[model samples]
Target: MDKKFAGKKLLVLGSNVGATDIVQYARDNGAYTIVADYYPADRSPAKRIADEQLLVSTADKDALEAFIRERHIDGILAGISEFNLLIAEELSARIGLPFYFTRKQWDMIEKKSDFRALCEKHGVPCPKTYVTGKEIPEDVMQQIRYPVMIKPVDASSSKGVFKCENEDDLRRYYPESLKESECGEIIVEQFVTGDEFTAHYTIANGKVTLASVDNRYPIAMQEGDPTTIPIARIYPCIYLDAYIEQVDAQMRALCAGIGLQNAILFVQGLYDEKTNTFNVFEAGLRSAGEAPYRFIKRVNGINAMHVLVDHALLGKTDFDSDKEDPYMKGKCCGIVSFVTKGGVVGSIEGLEEATAALPDVIEYECRYPVGSETPCGRTLRQLMIRFVMICDNREKMAEDIAYLNSHITILNDRGEDMVFKMKPERIWGIQ
Candidate 1:
């Protein structure tokens, strides 16, 4: 087999969920991969898969940069972590490497306040946000409606975010939100009660394309939890055509205004079915941690890992960028993430059986093994195992998911079924 990247050495920062795939993708293409983080090899799975493991913290900029120089790293890829993107862009610029975004471009989209401003500038619909970096004014507070969201301007994985049902709720969560941010900033925005949706986009040679959109079905959240991240996401976002007609052009304008080129991003938002509106809350500037790229590749044959690797290896893009099928090309795809309650995983079951039985399950991974402690699996942090599949329709997806759900279980020391709290059958149209 010919090795396209035989001579190249790629540096992947942060052992995020997506980093494993990025490392594997690069290594498969004949490049040496380095996984950098401060975690033990057991904690960060990507470290075990890489050609080399650098036990240096990605946040230690000085030491990390020195290692890059010493290793003669050819490229650095920060696929999904919000904090790691800043580090990647900085180190890439300092070392005269090819980065998708400059400091200005990174600032424009990474921060919630700035991205909201950019959306408003280009006529894209985002939540109506109040002041950032501090609490809302007393006078403004009186005029505001109930049910708002307070979150840090620069944080990911839904950390330090709160869904405030009233003024008291906002006041209580404001300081906590601020504490989560490295920049000591917070944004209070209107909280929409509707189905959450995520629209994925890929930019190439200055042209933007809406690759796919999916509806995020949230796990039933416990009280005091931040807005629930999804337990499962089904593609062909029933509102796909509506999105193209209403918000796609404005989004393209927003990306063009910021001069973003050659990258993948997904806008996280809620769609009000009653009002027929799509409102955004977050914009991730790389492959989503949910691993939407897996579905995109399985459905349409465009590998996002390949696209990102091409960009990181210095401006060379070998794949076609203009092709996109946001409607999923007449196919149905689903990503089911099994989440458990807070505790040490005393046992795990049916993993091997499900993988063997379910032919449609393209990929699945469980990060928290037996005996591993998971702190509040409500957030994306504690996702036990994620299964991605593509099939013909929602009915088939429902059957497969129901079967898989019945098979897999993550129990704590209490001998309870941890992941059965919100069965996928609820939204997937199965009894």
Candidate 2:
């Protein structure tokens, strides 16, 4: 058999869930893969799957360079996290490897303020936003409308984002919110009320070759939580055709304006039915979290994990253009995140039985161990478990989810138990 990437060695940074998938995909494509992570061998799942594991902090330049030198790595891939992204760019530059984004481009995308400014310069339809500090600037404050959204400029996953209704709310939350962020700068923007959605695409040689869009339904969230975890995502979004076209145009323009060349692009936006407009929110130069992976695979019959690896190694994708998955046509796939209220998981019922019954159920992952305490949102240990499922029939999808919800149980510290439930607003709409 002729190997597509026989001689290439791919070094994947971060051993989180996303990284492990990427590593496995690369290995399946005949590439020698090395998983480098800061955690110990036992804690790293990618380490178990890769050809070799290297215990090195990608944040440390010297340590990262030494590992690259010792291993003779030819390419690099980064997971969805921000820290891993910065390190990936640095290593790519230092080792002369094929990287998706340049150091400057990565920095621009990482910082919320920089990304907003780039969007403005390029005429992308982003929310009207302003930066704030000790005393809010008169002009900047005046520009923002009531019910504004305030967040840290450099935070990811929706950390420190709050909807401030007036000056009092802003004054009350401003100080602590700024202090809590890694970067002290904060962004205040006009909060648009509309249906939220996300777009995912892959750029190669500065052009978008593949793309998909999904409707976002936020599930669990508290005061300090980054954006609410998504409960379900419906693909081929139920939007006017013109609105989808507008979104696609905005994404293409933003990528071209920022000089974004290669890698996956995850863009979030809101669709205002009243005005028939799509407002651009945030764009990350990485794959959507594992939530959407199953949906994309089901709809397109393409493994995005393999696509990312192939692009990293050969600068081209191996998508079978003629082949398509009929299950996705005019059908919706939903992913429900099984969130425990608090504390360690005592027992999870019906997971194996559910999977056995519903083969379309892609994966059910327990992020924490049986006895480990699951941390609340805002901490690094937010995710407890995720139950991902898919089906061609929307009614059957709802039935499976309802059945799963009734079966799974999570107990807290006081012996009180709670089952995962989807907020009604998340399923239908806030209105």
Candidate 3:
């Protein structure tokens, strides 16, 4: 058998769930993979599959550079890790290794203020934003209206994000958002109401080669919940076709303006049905989190993970990029994440049943092993389990999800069924 990445040394940063999948994908392509993470060897599942495991912080650029140098690594790869992306950019630049995004380019997109400015300069549709440093001036605060969103300028995964309903709420949450920022900067933007959608694009040689869109929604958020915790996503966004052409044009223009090349980006936007317009709010110069890699492979018969490795590591672009490509035609797919209450988790039931009974179950995963204590599992960051479901149509999806809701259950040590206190609005539905 011919190994495409034979003898290539690929250094993968951060051994979280996303990094673990990337490591396995690289190894399958014949690359000698090394998993580096802050977590211990026993706790990190990605480490177990790697050819070598190093318990080191990905944020520490010097240590990572030394490890890469000592190993004579040929390439570096990172996904679903915002902090590590910066480290990868710095290390790749220092060692004279080719990288997807330049340090300057990464900085522009990494900071919320810079990204908003770039969007404005390129005529990209985005929410009006006010970038604050240390404090929001009285004059600046006066212009802002109620129901705005305050977010850390350089944070991801909603670390320091809050929705302020009034000036009082802003005063209380402004400092909280600032704390999550390394530079003590935050962006307050007008909160838009619409269905959220994320676009995935693969750029090679300064041109977007592959593109797809998905609808994203927060799960487990209760009524009046201020924080946005996205625990579910549906592929082939039901509303994508309504404005696909316009959004595609905007994405291409944004990439051209940023000079982005040889990378995968997740562009987040809101779709206003009333106006029939898509408003892009933010974008990341990295792969979108979730099981998109597997979804693309199963639906399109294309292994996008392999293409990601080839592009980010080998500077190659030998992959499909047709916009009209047939992937899971006449099918609807979605995923739901299970969040448990904080306590000692005994065991979960109905996973086997879910796979067997669901019309087209694709994958199922559990984070905590039996007898493990779930730490704040009710929080988005501590999701206990997740499973994917595919259906021939939207009706089947709704029916299967209904079945899952009634059948699946998580329990605690005292034999009490853990009920997910999801907000009524967040109940599963096809977006």
lDDT of each: 0.80, 0.68, 0.74
| TM-score head-to-head 1 vs 3, winner | 1
**Reference-based TM-score of each model:** 0.87, 0.85, 0.86
lDDT of 2 by residue, 37-84 (tens): 778878888888889888777777788788778878778886677678
Clashes of each: 0, 1, 0
Off-target runs (Cα >4 Å) in candidate 3 are 38-43, 55-60, 130-137, 166-172, 323-328, 357-359, 375-378, 421-431
Please provide, for model 1 over 242-358, each residue's C-alpha lDDT reduced to its tens digit, 9 standing for 90 to 100: 888889999988887777768877788777878988888778777676778787877788876677787888586666765578877888887888776778888888889987898
Per TM-score, the best of the predicted structures is 1
Question: Looking at candidate 2, what is the lDDT of residue 236?
Answer: 52
List the lowest-lDDT window of 10 residues for candidate 1.
422-431
Off by over 4 Å in 2: 121-123, 130-135, 139-144, 157-159, 171-173, 180-184, 220-228, 240-242, 316-327, 376-383, 411-415, 423-431
